[model samples]
Target: MSLLVTLAASTEELAPLLMPPLAFAGIAAAIFIALGFVVFSFRDVANRQGQGAGKSSDTHGSGH
Candidate 1:
């Protein structure tokens, strides 16, 4: 019982957060959104290479 009381008291005396808990979540959300934009920017890249870009006389059989 005494050990439990001591542990609770120690936990209550710990240092405060540098930022609010919500701020940490917001920072993580912003980073994910930025990365999402980066991935979105690469959309349809294969189609932009023009027709017949992958075809060649040396290749054979469905290309795969």
Candidate 2:
């Protein structure tokens, strides 16, 4: 039938991926690793501030 022919023609016109399917997973993993490094870099940030590195002690108040 003509309908079967049209369906077969449409199925053949599929789009191609810009990259392989596994490459997409690799890209996402790389992004997460980079973000993990960024977060790790700030690991001791709070401790640095508590050490009187830059902030003045009296900023919170003299009551302590």
Highest TM-score: which candidate?
A: 2
Top candidate on lDDT is: 2
Q: After superposition, how far is residue 55 of candidate 2 from its true place, in Å?
A: 7.7
- List, residue by residue over 8-54, the lDDT tens digit for candidate 1: 77856558999999999999999999999999999878676644455
lDDT of each: 0.80, 0.86
Model 1 C-alpha lDDT versus the unseen true structure = 0.80
lDDT per residue, candidate 2, 1-64, as tens digits? Answer: 9999898778565699999999999999999999999999999999988888435767766565
TM-score quality measure for candidate 2: 0.64
Deviation in Å, model 2, residue 63 alpha carbon: 3.0
TM-score of each: 0.60, 0.64
